[model samples]
Target: MGMSAGYELSRRGLKTLLIDAFDPPHPNGSHHGEPRLIRHAYSGGPAYVKLALRADELWRELEEATGEKLLERAGVLNIADPDVYSYAGRFQDAADHGVRIEDLDADQIRFRWPDVRIPDHYRAMFEPNAGYLYSEKCVAAYKKLALHSGASLLPNTFVKRIQAERSFVSVFTNTEHFIANHVILSAGAWFKTLEPFVRLPIRSVRKVVGWFEPSVSSFEAGTFPGFTFASSLGSYYGFPDIAGAGVKIGRHETGEEWQPGEDLVPFGAYSEDEGDLRKALEAYMPDAAGKLLKSAVCKYEHTPDDHFIIDTHPEHSNVILAGGFSGHGFKFASVVGEILANQIELGHWGRDVGLFSAARFSPISP
Candidate 1:
C-alpha cells in the first residue's frame, strides 16, 4: 500500500519519500509471496467490487507504463459446496455489480481442470479477467517509477517515532528526524509498535504459504486458473504451477498472534506451516497435493472486522492511515495507493470509504 501510494504521490510531482524498514520487495510483509491473488465479484466482509475493478484498470496502466509482466490473465475460480455463504456471496455480488461469472458444476470443473477432484455437489464461479499479480515485481516496478518521478526512498531505515502535529508530521528514523507537510503511515504489522498509534484497533498475526510439488502437468498455468476453495474443514487459496514452481497454496484464516518488532519465525519453523495447506489439498485438490517444496511466512494486520483501515487519523487530518488490510489487501494496492494520494492531495476521495473508517472501533486517544 505504501509503495503504490508513494508511486502515485511521487508520479504526480509531489515531493515524496518512501521509508522501508527492510528493502522493498523484501520478505518482511504480506507482499513477499511471488503471486498474490487478484479476483473480484466479492463477499466475505465489505463490498469491494468497484474498488477492485478500478484496481484492475490501474494494474493494466502500470503494466503499460513499466512494460513488466505484472499481472497474469490466467483467470480465477471460486469453488465451494452448495449454499456456502462466502461463495454464494460472490455470485450475488457478481450479479449486483454486472460482473460476469461463468457458472460451473463440479463435473465441468473437473473436466476443465483435470487436477481438481472436488465432490459432485461442488459449484464454482469463474471470473475470466481475474488472476494474480507478481507481487514482488509489482513493488519493484512501482519503486523504479517512483524513483524516476523524483521520489526519495529511505530503504533499511526503520522509523522509530512519528509525531502528527496539527500542521505537519514529524517522522523520526534511526538516523535522523525529518518533518513533512503530510505523512501516510502505510505500515503493516509494524503499525502496532508505533507508540502513540498503538491504541488503534489492529492486531498482527503470522501466516504461512507453501509451494507443493504436483504429481501431474495438468496443474500448470493456462491449463488451470487460480482458485479459492471453501469446505467444512476450512478455506484455502492457490495458484497453478507456473514454470515448474509447483502449486502455491495458503490458508485464508487462522494464524498465531504475532508481535510486530520480534523476528518472524521462519516458514517451516512450525509443522502446521506445511500441514495446514496439505490438509486443504488432501481434501479438495488431491491431484496437486504432492510433497511440499518450499514455504514462506507473512504477516497480516487485521482490524476487529477483517475489512481495511483506509481512513484519516482521528487526531490529525494531515496523517493518513492505511493498514489493517487483514488478509485480502494485496490486490487493492494499486487503488488504495491512489485513494491515499487523493485523500492527501485532493483532500477528498471520489469513492465512499465509510466502511474503512476507524470510527467503527472504539475511539482512541490522541
Candidate 2:
C-alpha cells in the first residue's frame, strides 16, 4: 500500500519516500500470491462499489502509465442462496454506477460453465469486470513507476518510531531519521503499533490457502472463472489456474489470531493444514477438491466488523492511517493509494467513507 501510494504521490509531483521492512514484493507482508477479487457488485456493502469503480479507473491508469496489465478481466462469480444473500444492494449500486453484472441460476450456471456443479438451491451474481490483479506484477510495476516519478523508496529499512508535531512528522528508522510534511501508515499488520493513534480493534489472524492440481486439465485457466461458494458451514473462494499454481482455494474466515511481531512461519514448517480445508472442499466443491498440490499460510488484519479502516489520525490531522483491510482490502489498493495521496494533500477525500470511519469503533469519552 505504501509503495502504491508513493507512486501516486510521485506522479502528482510531490516529494515522497516509500519505506518497507522487507523487499517490495516479499512474502513477509499480506500483499502476496493470495488472489484478490475485484467485484463491483460487492456483497460486503454497496458504498464500496463507488470506491471499487474509482479503483478500476486508477488501476487502468497505472497499467497505461507503466505499460503493464495489472487488472485481468476474467470476471467474478459471487454465489449464494437468493433468499439468504440477496443482491439488492449490490445490484442497485451497480445499476446506479453503470457496472455490468449477469444473474445466473443453477441451470443457467451449468449451461454456461459445465465444469462447475452448483446445487439447484444456489444462485450466482456474475460481474464481467471482475478478475485477478496479478499482485506481484502490479507491485513491480508500481515500484518501477514510483522510482521513475522521482520517489525515493528505501527497502529493508524498518520504521522505528514516528514523532508527530504540529506541522510535520519525524519518521525514525534504525539508521537515520527524516521529516515529512505528511505521513501515511500503510503498514499491513503492524498498524496497531502506532501509539499516538486510536487503539483500533483489530486482530491479526493466520489464514491458510491451498492450491489443488486437478488430476484432469478441465479446471485450468481457459476453462474456469473465479468463483466464491457460500455453504451451510461457511464461505470459500477459489481462483483458476494462471501461474501454474493450480486451483487456489482458501476459507473466507480463519481460525486463529496472532500479534504482528510474532514469527509468521508455518507451525510445523512442512505440515499441511489440508485436513481442515479438505473437509470444507469435499462438502462444498467436491470436484475441484480432489487433488491437492501444496498449501501455505498468510496473515490477515481483521477489524471488529471485518470492514476496512481508511481515515486520518484523530489527533494529528497531517497523518493518515490505512489498515484493517481484514481479508478483502487488496482489490481496492489502486484507489486506496489515490485516497491516501488525496487525504495528505487536500485533507479530505471526496468519497463517502462513513462506513469505514474509525469513529464507528470509538468509545464514549466519559
Highest TM-score among the candidates is held by which one? 1
Question: Which candidate number maximizes lDDT?
Answer: 1
Backbone clashes under 3 angstroms, per model: 0, 0
Off by over 4 Å in 1: 44-46, 83-86
Lowest lDDT 10-mer window, candidate 1?
83-92
Relative to the true structure, candidate 1 reaches a TM of: 0.96
- Candidates in order, TM-scores: namely 0.96, 0.93
Q: Rate the local accuracy (lDDT) of all candidates.
A: 0.86, 0.78
After superposition, candidate 2 runs with Cα above 4 Å error: 82-84, 196-198, 265-272, 363-366
Model 2, 1-366: lDDT tens digits are 777889989989999899998888878777777567777777666678888888888889888987877787888877786655666567777887889998888888878766676679778888877887887777888899999999998999988888889999999999999999899887777765654444677788777788876655666776677878776656778788766687888777755777778877683343436765676656645666767777767888888899888887777778787888988888888888888888877767767777888778874111
